[model samples]
Target: MAGSLRYRLQPIRKTKMYRYDQYDHLIVKERVAQYRDQVRRRLADELTEEEFLPLRLQNGLYMQRHAYMLRIAVPYGMLSSPQVRMFAHIARKYDRGYGHLTTRQNIQFNWINLEQSPDILAELATVEMHAIQTSGNCIRNTTSDELAGVAADEIIDPRPYAEMIREWSTFHPEFAFLPRKFKIAISGAEQDRAATAVHDIGLHVVKNAEGEVGFRVLVGGGMGRTPIIGSVIREFLPWQHALTYLEAILRVYNQHGRRDNKYKARIKILVKALSAEEFARQVEAEWLDIKDGPATLTAEELQRIAQYFTPPPYETLPATDAGFEGQKTDNKGFANWLKRNVKAHKVSGYAAVILSVKKTGVPPGDITAAQLDFVADLADQYSFGEVRVTHEQNLVLADVKISELFTVWQAVKAQGLATPNIGLLTDIICCPGGDFCSLANAKSIPIAQAIAEKFDNLDFQHDIGDIELNISGCINACGHHHVGNIGILGVDKDGSEWYQVSIGGAQGNNTSIGKIIGPSFSAQQMPVVIERLLNVYVQQRTEEELFIDTVQRLGIAPFKEFVYASPIPTGYTHGEDACVY
Candidate 1:
């Protein structure tokens, strides 16, 4: 809430993980200097708004509904304690006293001052962080699994590959200005935690029959006005050619992708227009020309990148900690927290913990400056001084020792970060909707608040079991409503706000889009409508069946009929002609 930026910039802290080379450091410093001058020129009435628009966007500055929003990238969702503390400082100094974590693994401050934007970038540069390629019609942050290195189901770690892509895509002259913003997500885990099926390119790390690691390539997957899942163009692409192959895909897309219509500029539209088979053919043809060019990933280069992501020096100990087990047995609250928030790590003596930011009454993914500092302390004390930001809008202490689980849980709970709702309906993934973002049709935070309040009973939420309920302010699908088991999308009818409901959508290996259930509803009717849909699911579900499976088995007819059983309002209708009550 401070209006003046007074904090002195600190010396850059040295980080062992993801160390930026001299070139990386130089790029960030030069960018900060350049942006500072740009701000000066704009303020002096030398640069017009039109002249400054693209320049400002290229640095991750956006003019939101109320103020400038600065998006800071967390490459592959990885963050160190010092870096997080910097975020807290920035939140308290330059903007409001909080930051919102986005679905793309970035943190956004919604109340930034235009003049202080350069200062913010300079502060971030002190920590080897920047906002480059975070906006504009360029390659955005390349996301990967939050549990990239330590997941038990992982065949190979994806962070090194993600880093490779980040290095390749950032400031690439040829592809700097694409048809539209491009996004890529890679997953090394078997469960697909990164939501790869919804990205422009989804790379799954796997092995071939000869026991050589490679990638399974998927192209043209996206969610927005047109929500289409990606199609697999190659079942297996050798690891050595990953970058070259990506270049080929981009080259093909660049050559033929539509540039006139911004609405239809995403690679998904092109893939659909050309057909997946034809698209694959074009990519392959382009790839032949640069199959083994300088961009080809070699074993030595991979090892160089992999060194930064090597596991921390972990203590050798028994898998089960007796103290932790006894504490779980004695405390029901701790037990519930463990059941929901704690996850299995590949190492026997360690576990991964998700510190929930979706507590009742708080906007999902919004963390205060004080809370950020608390998480930093937890990271330093128990989790190797590092944390990860999840695509689902939560933070993870990925390397917590098993013996410290109870202590970590208690610390987090005291700070209101231990909501014990990881995958339940209350653990909603939502965007900063009409409240902050200029593009939203309706307010999304209030809807999430209403639903979380309605399901205030932990016992009731636990009974409902694992389910995904996502709310997006608009069809941009930044909230990923299309893939939730129950999705809520805000829409505009005339001059009022309404919501459309969908069922049967899911993410992961078997990803599918949800179908619209019926007519839109008023804001006040949302909780009850959701209650009706859950009522149908509860009544029709077989023993211990998850929500998605039940929907897939019984179909949406039962749920749709149950929701629409009541008489339609006097002037209300479905689809484009519908009237908001």
Candidate 2:
């Protein structure tokens, strides 16, 4: 994969998202104005809490522990440099000085003053971004592989299709009020970085036997009190039929999904109520009417959307760059960053660099205003003026030249983003937990910090290799606890916060739900328990076998025995409200 390097001058697209037409702009403007009036009414005591709750939620405003929180959609996780700067401005002005990235690749601004929310939405509209469809019982932000367009193993760039769906789902009248919230995730790559298997609908883009592009669609997957991996409802659906088929599935769920029990309202429960086979049969029957209707895609429409996502002008260069290789050889730190943060790109000599927001001692996925503004400038200079948010809670520079990686690493290191811990144990995916989330059963950030501190040695983390540690403050599984190789769920017993540990879980093409290791442990005991489990993995594992692979081979029995057999459980306090170690 080597050749002579040549300069290729190309123009960068000013935008990566679906270009908003007059209709799109008008719709958003109308919604914002309506919400502004609604807020005024509520403030004037003309509206009650019951009257205003749904209105605020649909606009992505949530009343959290501290104040109103705003969730902004990063459509398909794509952001331009200008949009990034807007986020920085909003963070500094409307709320705190930082924003938290979510597992769904959305951004949450905490401490937002309720009165200023309309203004925030107004600002977002100018950037072709919004808070609509990000909350409530409708289609949430349609998540996809963070490396949607450029991943080496991608079948087709999924962003175009994701944008199509985004357009269809936005303000969809029929789905505005469903039984419960619904999420959809798409994966274009051979590997499933989007964690699609745990969403309400998981869409895997595939090429069929005849080389026609299509989707292998999964349904009934969800995480919460009952975590269920999705079942493939369609082995292969032609690209044109995606919308119609989706409509059928949603229509069936909307009609028959349990509304009496909000607990069982998710489509997953419906799939369980009737078998997956039955569910598929029903969907097929329902799809017959709508299959070739107005909703069916035209090739021209697809091309129009795809035109927005064309690759930027890439240089004709050898796969291996001398400067990149030299830096890797000359500096141990630079070598580590390359191995961890940098990922292979489909285009030769271009690599995707992940800027880890999960630095040691910081809350996972949290980034300050200044840091985001810095990233915005870096994107303009180094990454074709674009950025992407990853489901793993990190930011990605999707198109950095291999030759420039060392220089980029130096700058990134200065900003403390050059953490050589990508895909490692300490690069944790975590939710806000009890610290900021009223829904959390216990705090998650401190536990993540403790584990990261205990294993801060990069050499040890690299040796451990590619372990995913995900933590959720409660069963809502906002942090995707059910899908991590090592999953930590915060549990409340009586009144005290106790942590439950699970192993063997994973999120990918081979997704699985983890099994619990027995009773819960206190916060102080969590990191120690984790260390002991890692010790078991080290002692029992064959060389280079990933932790999840080893767990699958040996089962949780051995790890469970090591943690519980220790004296900590015996010495631990058992009071209803004690925080005893």
TM-scores for every predicted model: 0.95, 0.95
lDDT of 1 by residue, 300-331 (tens): 77877777787888899789878988999999
TM-score of candidate 1 on Cα atoms, chains taken together? 0.95
Candidate 2 regions with alpha-carbon error over 4 angstroms: 1-15, 569-581
For all candidates in order, the CA lDDT equals 0.89, 0.88
TM-score computed on alpha carbons, candidate 2: 0.95
Model 2, span 490-552: residue lDDT tens:
999899999999999998988999999999999888877877788888888897799999999
In the predicted model 1, the residue pairs found to clash are: none
Collision count of model 2 = 0
Q: Which numbered prediction scores highest in lDDT against the true structure?
A: 1
**What would the C-alpha RMSD of candidate 1 be, to one decimal place?**
5.9
Q: Model 2 scores what on Cα lDDT? A: 0.88
